[model samples]
Target chain A: MNTPNTSPSPEVTRTYRRLIPNTWWLKQRSTILFMIREWSSVFVALYAICLLGQLWALSEGPERYNALLAKSLSGGSLLLHLVMGAFVLYHMVTWFKISGRIFGSGPLSPGAVTAVNYVVWIAASIGVFYWIF
Target chain B: MCLIKFIKSLEPLWWSLFGLGGAIAAFLFPAHILIQGVLIPAGILPKDMLQYENFAGLLSSPIVRIYFLALIVFPLYHAAHRIRMTLEDLRIGWLNAILPLLCYGGATTISIAAVVVILRLS
Candidate 1:
């Protein structure tokens, strides 16, 4: 067995340790899923940026805003949205499943929290839809 | 040392933002995506609904302003955090010191811009 060096090794040249595989996340199903879930953020960030652009366009006035809106509705943007939407949907679904872990596992159970999450989500979205359209 | 400690202390802040953003993203983003991506594209929701006048009018409401602000901003920080973690998971250890700063800084800058835009929209 190699003995531990309690003292500092300022003068000693330490050998480089073997690095973790870049694909280490692929070793486990959960880790792979988590990585994919994390990837959803890229799309989220893209959409957020686009929305900010829309806000800027709104600030610009009706003509520019209309142009931006038209661009967003074009074929390219639609395809982008479909792809991004899939990722975001995956993100949302996984998030609901694990939200209890984030907020703290309080008196309410995870399942209950998830149920409440879905309920609130549906209600709020419907409310927003009504308010907006 | 103090600077390091300060940076270290930001962990909780980042984590909290990540959780909050995740919650918002899960709860509200789907509806927005469906409307903007599917309904609007398919013409089921008339293009007029997204017209400048209509959208601007919709955003003029205080509640809608707040909702849009939240919707646009939180996910940014959340994405930053996730991107940082994803990089770490990729075994990019050399970037440890700078990654958080870059990611969170970008998110902060954009969030501030978003807030300003939302505030000025009315």
Candidate 2:
């Protein structure tokens, strides 16, 4: 079969192997964003680990829990939390954006699915903030 | 490779956890991080937000405990799934063999620890 490859032997067929680099996601803006969205889950898990530690300390006693709180309120922790919060925010947005497709065209449109997710997310955030602060 | 194949066959289980965890992360994590991380730490909110007595009371409530458990547990699996897949994407040779066990196993271990902690909270 004739093809558009400017080759001396166009009739020859070969396998197509996807040779991608470790940093292949870096090649494009969308891929970079996609990788970041996927990769930031590590930090998300770290924060959960930290939360677990806090609970463990709480189970231990008030003294230990308060001490942990003191550390959590430090400048370093504030910085780390800021970073973690941003990553989680990104995770939320990306996940919800993709969440709409879960409905397909069955009943709710993709935009409706995404909108409902965002609405619920905002309500949950507000409820949490009210409970805490 | 029997063990590896067995784990590979459990992809749907891992994927289901990932979606559940993703939903939890989206709805809850940012708010907790914003309050516990940003507000209290920066002194924008009163310190009692994390006062041990208040927090302990919160933990005593079964609802809060369940919420905390969900918060502390599921996102871990979500993260583990992502991490394992990312390692696979990197095309590392030996890593492909161990990544699933290492990542999901780590998540399972931590989740168990969290449950123990919550169960023992007084």
What's the lDDT for candidate 1?
Answer: 0.83
Model 2 clash pairs are none
Error of 1 at B114 (Å): 1.1
Q: What local lDDT does model 2 show for residue B49?
A: 67
TM-scores of all models? 0.87, 0.89
lDDT of 2 by residue, A7-28 (tens): 7654455657788778887899
Name the TM-score of chain A in model 2. 0.79
| Candidate 1 wrong stretches, greater than 4 Å | A1-18, A100-108, B1-5
